[model samples]
Target: MAGEPQPSGAPTKGGWITFPFLIATMAGLAVASGGWVSNIIVYLINEFNIKSVDAAQIANIINGCVSMFPILGAILADSFFGSFTIISASSLISLAGIVLLTLTAVIDSLKPAPCENGSTLCMGPSKTQLGILYTSLALSSIGVAGTRFTLATMGADQFDNPKHQGVFFNWHFFTMYAGTVVSMVGFVYMEDNVGWGLGYGLCVAANLIGLAIFVAGKRYYRLMKPQSSPFTRLAYVIVAALRKRKVLLSSKSEDYWQETQAEGTKFVRTTPTNSFKFLDHAALIIHGDTNSDGSIKKQWNLCTLQQVEDLKTLFRISPLWSTGILLSTPIAIQISLTVLQVLAMDRHLGPTFQIPAGTMMVFVMLSSSISLAIIDRFLLPTFQKLTGTSATPLQLIGVGHALNVLSMAISALVESKRLETARSYNLNGNSIVPLSVFWMVPQLVTVGVGEAFHLPGNVSLYYQEFPKSLKSTAAAMVSMYIGIAFYLGTAIIDFLQKTTRWLPNGINDGRMNNVYWVLTLIALINFGYYLICTWLYEYQNVERKELSKSSPYPC
Candidate 1:
């Protein structure tokens, strides 16, 4: 009890230390796997003699599912399994998958033989040889998605005390980016030279090492117990909605929609409340409990359903945040699509001077890293001074979305130039795009702008929307939205590719510039939607009060 968090298993200094280590491990494994995965596309295309777009789509489809699978993990974590167990177990599952993937590289499928040199895990002769490869990828994705939310909440448990809360968040984001930096550079080079098997093997090793670190500090983690399934509450909501619908249509149901006038979350009615009173779902913006001296104090009180329901609550108040997920969908493309655009199309330099396609990731990494650092070093303080408190995270979100919109337009036009150049010349070998690569700098820079806005806002928003106990689940909710959008984005792209003739049959011959132009148009629409939702995004209570003091009202 002495070391345990107040509401959970005993907290110890060890748990806190172990908690971050596990998280960092997770971060390293996730991003590093991603780095290798990106390079793997080049290997698959070269090794198998597949088309470029085919390789791109294969990568896209597999990763697209990563975001959506977390919901299953969240559901189980919220109900049957606690965070610690799920994370550890999932990591083990993923580690197995990684081993199988490495084996594929050495073992040959044809004639029960191996690769030219005869290895154990190398692929077989046909496209079917990749089936096991895909399975391994799926397993890793499952492990990652399942444990992602489980561990994040586990980490937040360390800083529930208000004093360390702000610092905890700042460090959390920092550690995440730090893990990303290491993986991006280290994994890419390894995957490029060694076969896919060894590169993937390294990723498994990273995850396992992180898991081992997590085990050492397990005593300090302050793991919370699981709760009842959220489906029950969702069922409750459905019944309530149905009952309300009947009442509304029958002209007697308005009372059903009213807030439980008593403050308790759930209360059954003997009968509908009124002859004339209409339920106001939007009204009664639930006020906080006040102390005897007029100060406000916060309490976290809820069940599994209540915790999960908070996502709906978050959506209600921060409609923009939910829609903001769509705006962010392009980001998943940062590694795959944007990389393709730069390497395959950008025409700024001649063949001799063109940057190696893989090197383009440096720009993406630079944008995310430098932009985040600048925000902390300069941008945050400058905004704090100028807007006082009113310039909130939501305000930054609007600015970020604006940048996303701008970048899309730039990519459409500049990338188009590269395509035009290639089409005009008969040169097939060592073909490079034209003046468009220079324009990538601005688009890439804007990626940083978008990151600075969305990352903090999403984190803070998820944390603020839920009670402290359910913070992890809330984080899952945020991630799930992104995941769903990601899966949807890939499916949409695939459907378009097959249904449309815009893409030529050759591997390197995608109408990439046209594709980006269409995406640019979509970004503008997403920007408009984000703008509409901006009025609803909120800041955390502490930040809100501090900002309230400013002379002008902005947030």
Candidate 2:
């Protein structure tokens, strides 16, 4: 009864019945997050009077924190609170942050005096003002960290079939991008045209609505119970292996300790594999390692073979995971830099409509949304029909890597052309160039397509391959690397500003094209490293012979 599959459309706690509520909530939160985050660069410049490069650096730090904090959220969910509790609490926290942010927009005392148009002199925000802004950003970022990937994991948990889970991931990203598109296009326009206060107010409303929708669907959720920290088990495995470092290896399965079931019940025993053989010592049946009844005497000294293998699995996949950090770093740099680029370029569309500088990112989101639809609806099915197998996650990631490299190259070329135009017009020192902002569309769309390929591929691979005990944490791994990438991007920008002349206070006064070239080189090198890692990597879950028969696309 425990493992039996629920009939389709049966009265169940989790299934397609929960889809609409989850998707709606995801879209709402995305709109809320995008409203403030997408426009923060302009807000700092116009409201707080911060310099452009400084604001971008600050934004990068905030992005890094938002991306990195998800691991802590995942840990809390996996070890103590569970997804439902964490998401609910986080939504409230996010609402509080947005309220504070809106207050900053409405209250003149909360920000600095605006600089006169074309005036070089500007008043910086006082310490108190900056403190309030930082606090609000911190709270909002923490809230986002908790809900973003955890929602993906929870949505996937609603279905037992891998194909269903894959489809859910596709829709999850689509809804997220769709919501971001709305915030970037709609809310950003309001912030630029109507008022920042009204724009932030909309974010607060969206957060409240999303939270309400999530709560309303509580009855249909199949919540996973919190397990004690999976990381603790991993630590125990490492400790046991190191303690038995000098012990001889055993070739026989009986020499390893396996976790047993209820008394007198039969269970399959897991034996340590030859890969990462040193860790097998943790599971070796030394004297005093087990009680007379065959239970573990000390967890710190004797780990189950299954635990050993879980640690080994992490070791095997970590190289691939490291590749994602480098891959993401360039994109993070591009995102912050692209906003600056848009600000300096002509944004007028037709007669009365001038594109919001912040809304340039909408192109990336829109491209990703469209590409996801095509990939899910046409590309995957077509690939399966032709080859009798769906495209592997590694292959998808590889394609993303190549596209990312090309995008960086294109960004460099575009930046070079923008600079040439600026010099031709004698525009300098933060002056806007006559170049159309649409010149950036190609690079933005390329990166968006790359994200559509890699983001889901990375998540699907991590979720499918990780041990069951670490499911939530597995989903958060992608966030962790992305966080690291953002930090790395910030660090690189800071170093370039301090050491090189490429990035200055005014991007037009510096060689911004060179920055794109550097990122392009970094991406190219990272792709080569990724190819090596993928070459050495073997599938632990998706490519299993039995599973291959059930689903062409296990991931």
Candidate 3:
């Protein structure tokens, strides 16, 4: 009765009923996050009098922390607190951080004196100011870590059908991007035209509204209880395997420790496969390894066959996972560099209106949102109808990889042209290039389209393949790699600054085009690496044939 489907049309705790609240909450948080994060580079340069390169470096580090802290959040959600608790607590933390940030904007003592136009002598923020700024950033980053992907897992958990889950993920990303686009355009405009105090005050208001909506949905949610730590079980398998290194291999299913369900239910026994055979030792039954009733006797010295296989699954998927790091690193580098590029180029749309440098990324978010909708509504259906089978996650990811390489190539060419235009005008030493900033839009749109293909693909692949017990952690893996990529991007910039003239403090004086070219090469190499990883990888949870039949737009 517990696992059986509810009767048709029966009332359910979660379904489309929770959609409005969840989507609203997601949009609200996205606006709040994008408002501050998108403008931070400009804020530091204009308000704090930090150098352009130094501001980019600081932004990269903050992005890294925001992305990386999701693992800790996921761990806590999976092992102790359920997603609801984490989301609630994190929302409050975000509100507090946003309030503090608003205070800094309003209070003169909290930031450096405004730098005069064309003046090189500018005072930086004091230690006390920097400390407060860092504290607010830290709190906000922690808040983002907890709620971003955790919300995805929680929303997906509401449905029993994988097809519905996949659709939800698509819309989830769409809502996120749509919110970002709004912030990039509206809030950034506010910050540029009105004042930082009003812009940040709006972010604080959005956070409060989002938190209230999320709390209002408590009754509609089908909340999953926290389980024992999946990481601990993974560790047990490793420890047990090493301890029983001398044990002989077994081919018989009965030799392995298998778990049995309820008495009335039929239990299917599974044997360890030949892949990663050394790990099979952990599942091999030994004296005193289990109690008389088949209960685990020593947690570290013995593990279920399922536990061993879960660890193997992680090992097998690791190469594919590693490829994501390289996949995202180039994008990270382009993001920070593009901000710098927009600053030096003319951003005017007409004689009366000029585009804010911070709002330039709106192109990426807009493209990604539109692309996601098109993919879900048209492309996927067309592909399925033509082939009588759905496109696989790996196929989508491969396409994304190819597109990313092209984006980098285009970025390099565009940056080169910008430099040429500057030289033609006899520009030097932080002078604005005569070229229009729209030149960067093509590459930004390209990367955005690539993200639409790969980001949800990666999340879908991990969620479907990972052990059910580690679902929250699986969703957070994307954040982890993105975090690593941001840090890697920072390191790459630092290395170039120290060793070469590729990334000078004043980007106009440096060969920024060469930097983009290097990223293009790196992306090409990484794409090749991704191919190899996908070639050898097999789907562990969903069979290829079954997956094709289930959903036209599977993840």
Task: Name the candidate that leads on lDDT.
Answer: 2
- TM values, all candidates: 0.75, 0.91, 0.92
Provide the overall lDDT of each model, using Cα atoms, as 2-decimal numbers: 0.57, 0.88, 0.87
Predicted structure with the largest TM-score when compared to the true one: 3
> Per-residue CA lDDT of candidate 2, range 216-332, in tens?
999888787877788989999999999999999888888998876788897876667779999999999898898888789999999888899889889999999999999999999
Candidate 1 overall lDDT versus native: 0.57
In candidate 3 the C-alpha lDDT for residue 422 amounts to: 84
Which candidate would rank higher by lDDT, 1 or 3? 3
What is the clash tally of candidate 1? 24
Taking the tens digit of each residue's C-alpha lDDT, what string does model 1 give over 107-146? 6551123335322244434656667767777777677666
Task: Sort all candidates by lDDT, best to worst.
Answer: 2, 3, 1
How many residue pairs clash (N, CA or C atoms closer than 3 angstroms) in each of the candidate models, in the order given?
Answer: 24, 0, 0
Ranking by TM-score: 3, 2, 1
